[model samples]
Target chain A: MSSLAAPLPATATTAASPASHEDRSSFAFLAIASLFFVISGIVALLVAGKLQMPTLLGNIAWLTYGRMRPLHVNGMLFGWLLAADMGLAFYLVPRLCGVKLWSEKLGMATMYLWVVIILGAVVEIPLGHNQGLEYAELPTWLDVLVVVAWLMFAANIFMTVANRKYEQMYVSLWYIMGAIIWTAFVYLVGNFATLFTTGVNQANLNWFYVHNAVGLIFTPLGLALGYYFIPKAAEAPLYSHRLSMIGFWSLAFVYVWTGAHHMLHGPISQWLQTVSILFSVMLMIPVWTLVYNFFATMKGQWHQLKDNVPIKFMMTGTIFYLLTCFQGPMHSLRSVNAIVSKTDWIVGHAHMAVLGAFSFFAVGGAYYAIPRMLKTRLHSQALANASFWLWLVGGLSFFVSLWIGGFLQGLQWNDPSIPFIDTVKFMKPFWSVRLIGGTFMFGGILLFFWNLLATWLHRSERPAETV
Target chain B: MIKKIDKNNILFVAAATGFFAIGGILTTFAPPLLDASWAKPAPGLQNYPELAKGGDAHADLVMKGRAIYVRDGCWYCHTQQTRTIEADTVRSGWRDVRSPVSTPDEFVFDKPHLFGTRRVGPDLSRAGGKYDKQWHATHFKDPRSLVPGSAMPPFPWIANNPAELDAMVAYIQSLGRAKDWRPTHDYEE
Candidate 1:
């Protein structure tokens, strides 16, 4: 499986090397970001396990399941996933655009601001200062900080793009650019910074913001990295540039409308719900295009899935992306939502998209990009392989268990004959399964982070010539 | 070396910015797009006509029930209104069939539609016709005893004595109300 390890053409590094100072600084930022994520992953495992036995945490105010659950989520999403994505973007965008970064100062400042904002979130969310929305758990003040940080990051990236030496913009550039721009717009509107003081429009705006945060922001970034890394690792070009373009536009068109799908079966207007459902169903076109393109690119290159760790991650991430999207549309169906709209089913669906799809791609991008950027061989391919399997299995387990549990709980709750207690009792078993699945996922995350740390810390003493 | 911004890129930026501008404008002028009627003011109590009617007595019970609801945080989980659908109606037992077919307006009386987002417990929109006072009392006292894995925290203080229990039951019964109707039979399993 490791047979694809041919040394790259020496010509790849012909361009002038930027000051080593900037490269080392970027590595330092990435290392800090990686450490934060690894810590968050550990905390998530602890929280998941503690929820199974609430008394284990001994009634500490900060450790309660209600508060800690959001902490775990925010920590992982923003602290880990967003930080890694930004770090990778900083590294990859310049390379892909055939130019040096627009401003290392801006990148460093953004990183520092991000750490401060995430610190505020880590403290506030668990301290019971949340706004009570699921994904929008951070209080108004921290949210503003995030927006500012994002603006700085966006400015840096856009400026870099503006100064690109590449004549033809690559597909990866489009995906990254779209992700950043759409996220800035969506974050502002969804958070309702303008109308928020009214209080009357909070719920509407909350769902709008929460859904798009995932659909527009994280999803696009993940797809961007996936598109870039998959082909790079496979030593192949993209299957079709036209298909990638169609996928990008269609996704942008469809994802915003689908936010109302979360409000299905609620007090939202029927027309709004109908619009959401329609857009959700229409999302299949973009999702399928990307899926088809990736799979088509692998038509004759199936052997790389086992041989290359990055390909393994990308392939599995893409597969989960397809499933998450398919499940998304199905769950949006009013008939299906009637049963599982508010249950752990949504949690399972979210994990599939966030953890299974996005996290996997992020890791794959890191694995592929980091070694190249550092000009060193990975410390252990075997560990990377193991991490891939663990993450893949753990993620699958979590998805399946929660999906079934959510369905069963929904069915039982709505059954007039079955007393609500019976439903709760029925779910005890599933809750136990969820805990186990969560443990597996946490373990897998630990393995991946461990491999990453080892690779970074134990690289060959002399850096290979720039490539 | 800064590359010149091209016409195509400028056009793209204008179009993208315009899309959001239009979205914001539409969101502003759009009629309250959400159906938050359940959370709206209902001048008087409303109940399902098909269920047993309780004229003035039922209205009093419902009023008493409202007090109990405020006291117990029943609003935390159970929503009081069902939307226009067979599944909703079937689950909550509150069908609004004024004409040959039911329309969305049937739930117009609902203020701030407590049609809640999560169901930590069952829907109490139609609780008045669904269960007897005894069942409500027992369940309130200890949900786990009845429904083995119930996440609904027990309201033992409300159930330790009979007077507190009656108030709780009264609130459950008052969820939906109507005049000129009598519950034909006592609520049963």
Candidate 2:
């Protein structure tokens, strides 16, 4: 076990290496993010139970469905997934650039600030101090702080890229840069511009932020991590540079137009809805191109999935990513949107991407990066494998039940014969199933946290105390 | 071409920005500014600021109710927009009659519009005059009592505060009440 203390041979392709604190920074971000993941998992379970029986929490204002729903959604998106993605970004950028992170002090500062912003959300959102926008629900002051935190992050990443020892960039680097730029632009427009606007325009702008927050930020960031880890874990080079180009460019162009699809059959303009659907279907091009690139890269590495846990996670995520993308485009069609627009089916589809796909990628990235960052192997690979099964089975059950339930609910809704309350009653059984699945997912996150903590505190190796 | 752009930082960033702007401008930025519906007031909103009685006080109650609605995250469950679909028209009727499909003009006064994403309860678009104030008060206190199997979280706190309760009921009753439409339903307490 003492052998773990021996320094990891520098993995950078060039002579430049990461600063010592970079390791600490990445580990801190992931650890805090994982804590939020666990917390949000508990919140999700409670929220799911409340959906089956609304009186579960006994009329507490703070624990009501409305308050807790945003907490669960934002907690998972910003508190868990985005935080984990940032940690992974910190891990990947320096290594890819063949240089130290631009500023270790700034990186640490940004991590702490990110934690503060998330904490503010946890406190304020449940207290009913939100912007009322779907994804941009944080209070105004907290939203301002978020912009500042993100800017600090973006500056560090860009400066690192600028100071790279390697002149030629990897595909992962492109995605990272794109994620930074796109997030800054969209976050500003969503949070700030919406403040100035009102009525239908506000709704339009709000959807733009909601969709892009996932598409431009998390999607690109998750893909960057996936691109790096899949190739590395499979011990194979990326399959097609052409596919990479086609995927990256097409996604960048197409994703922005599709936010309006969320408002389809509602009050948005006909032409806007038409353009959104057109672009949404065009989204298939990027998704397939990327999926093919990933699968092709895994050629002859199929056996790695049996032993390499990171590869297993990345592959599952890639497959789920394919499904999520397809479902999203299909749901945008007028006929399909009419059935599933506001149902639990949208909820199911949402979880497929954030949890089944991107969360999987982040977990895989953490599995790969955390061990390397700490200079030790995971404390319990068995526990890691157990958690994976829990996530997969639990996630599938949650998604499938909701999809079925939401479809039934939608059908019942369209039939004038059935009363609204009956539709709500019809969903009770599915919500119960969802709650059960959520419990398993919550258990999975606990194990995930336990495994990471054990790996971090494992007696064999600890990071040096004095820098 | 890929290699050249990938190697040059400025060009790569420029290309990314340009592609993002092309779709972003067309979908989100351009449409609202260009559309006439965004600025025009709907017929339903014509008398919203002036009720039949207690004009300023009634308007104040509606605004206060709007704030309460936003604060409680009511919009998360009860969507304001009535889609131009059969399900919406049939389910969320106005005083037992189907209201017209929602228009952009109807939302002119709503800052940070509450066109919510989900229907965890029911569409509140045509909620006005569908139930009496007493029904709303009872519903808020315990949703399942009136409509069994409702998953809506009870706002029992509102029952203790008459002012807030009245405001909430007023705001709900203000929905979908065009110049021609009038409050008709009167439920027994």
Best by TM-score: 2
Fnat of candidate 1: 0.10
Tally clashes: model 1: 23
Interface RMSD list for the candidates:
6.2, 1.1
TM-score of 2: 0.94
lDDT of each: 0.67, 0.85
Residue-level lDDT for A313 in candidate 1:
91
Worst 10 residues of 1 chain B by lDDT: B95-104
Chain A TM-score values, per prediction: 0.92, 0.94
lDDT of 1 by residue, A1-467 (tens): 01111222233334665433234335545565666777787777766565355345634545655566677778888888888888878877887777788888777778778878878887786566655455666777887898898898888878887788775666667667777877877777655452332222444555666787888889888888888888888988889977987887677667777666766765556777787798789989989999999998888999988779999999999999999999999988988887887677877898899989998898888888777666677767887888888777777777888889889888775655665556656666666777777777777776766766666665555355544
lDDT of 2 at A183: 93
Q: What is the CA-based DockQ of model 1?
A: 0.12
The true-versus-predicted C-alpha distance at residue A264 of model 1, in Å, is 1.7
Question: Cα RMSD for candidate 2?
Answer: 4.0
